[model samples]
Target: MSRRVSDVMTRGSRALPLDATLYDAARIMRDEGIGDVLVTLDGRLCGLVTDRDIVVRGVAERRDARHTPLGEVCSADLVTIGPDDDLDTAARLMREQAVRRLPVVDDEQRPLGIVSLGDLARAGGVDPGVLSGISQAPPNL
Candidate 1:
């Protein structure tokens, strides 16, 4: 009996349109106490934007947060999971993708929730070393 992703995911994750500005995404992250947000186009998941993305891609690049759209800085190369998937699958995907967060989407690619390293940690099944590796600062950073 494996645990489903929905069992440990953070439901009702925040999302914003691709046309939305970085400031909009940052404001939502601040209000929700979340580090990332799903980026959508015409209500379909298209990309993901994170606090690090805002800092490195948006700020560090000198893009005006208020004028720059999320589509411009969001990570379009996404690896999503399904709510019905097992925790092991989530862990494997995160490891293979070297990503700390995964958007849980449906067959239609509409985001349902978000699964993060912290969420997996609280679930108590994934290996701690794997978690540690994911949380480690990148060599270039």
Candidate 2:
């Protein structure tokens, strides 16, 4: 049987507020060694911001980290996964969307956890054929 996404997802993930300062979010990520954080507003999942977002959108833009809010820099139209979804489905979505992380949401759209590419790799459920295909692909080709 295929493993469920929830089985492999990182449960009890930390989240940042949409109105939070970029510097604080970056500090949290650095301290926790997290690549991304879910952006929530009033206890509802609203968007997401990754480490790259801070560099490109905040730093590069010369935006003040102390004043810049997460919502202004986050990707609001986030691609999400359901806890009941299979790992294969999650992987497919990640590949198609070119996103390294996916938020696992409950039926009420409440975030339960997050799944990263590292998690999927560690899960060891990706088919051997798929791994071989990826290996055959050339870098940036």
Candidate 3:
């Protein structure tokens, strides 16, 4: 059987509340050496924010990072997968959606873990067999 996404997901991923300041969120990401952070609301998955979000949306707009809330800048329309999803499915979803990170959620839509391209790359070879299916199939919604 193919490896499951949960097997590769980074558990206890650093996360932030939607109401948190952009500066706070950025600090967490920088300290963790991670590019993305899951946005939560009362311990439930709401969206995701990335370093690029700060640079492109916050910095470019000249907004005060300390004053701006993460929710305002986060991508609310998130593409996610359940922990039971296969690694291949995660890879295909990432490629089709043009997202580098995928949040793994539980039944209640609570964030359980996160998977990134780096994780996939490091764990598997460049052409990780897990993603071969994605390479063959056309993009599907």
Clashing residue pairs found in predicted model 1: none
lDDT of 2 by residue, 56-81 (tens): 88999999999999988988988899
* Cα shift from native, residue 49, model 1 (Å): 0.5
Q: What are the per-residue Cα lDDT tens digits for candidate 1 across 1-141?
A: 999999999999899999999999999999889888999997889999999999999999999999999999999989999999998899888877788889999999999989998999999988888888877735222
Listed per model in order, the count of residue pairs whose N, CA or C atoms clash below 3 Å is 0, 0, 0
lDDT of 3 by residue, 15-115 (tens): 88989989998999888898878899999999888888888889999989999999889888888999888777788787777666789999999999898
Off by over 4 Å in 3: 125-141
Best by TM-score: 1
Which should have the higher TM-score, number 1 or number 2? Answer: 1
How many times do residue backbones clash in model 3?
0
CA-RMSD of model 3: 4.1
Predictions in order: lDDT:
0.90, 0.83, 0.82
What would the TM-scores of all predictions be?
A: 0.93, 0.88, 0.85
* Top lDDT prediction, candidate number: 1
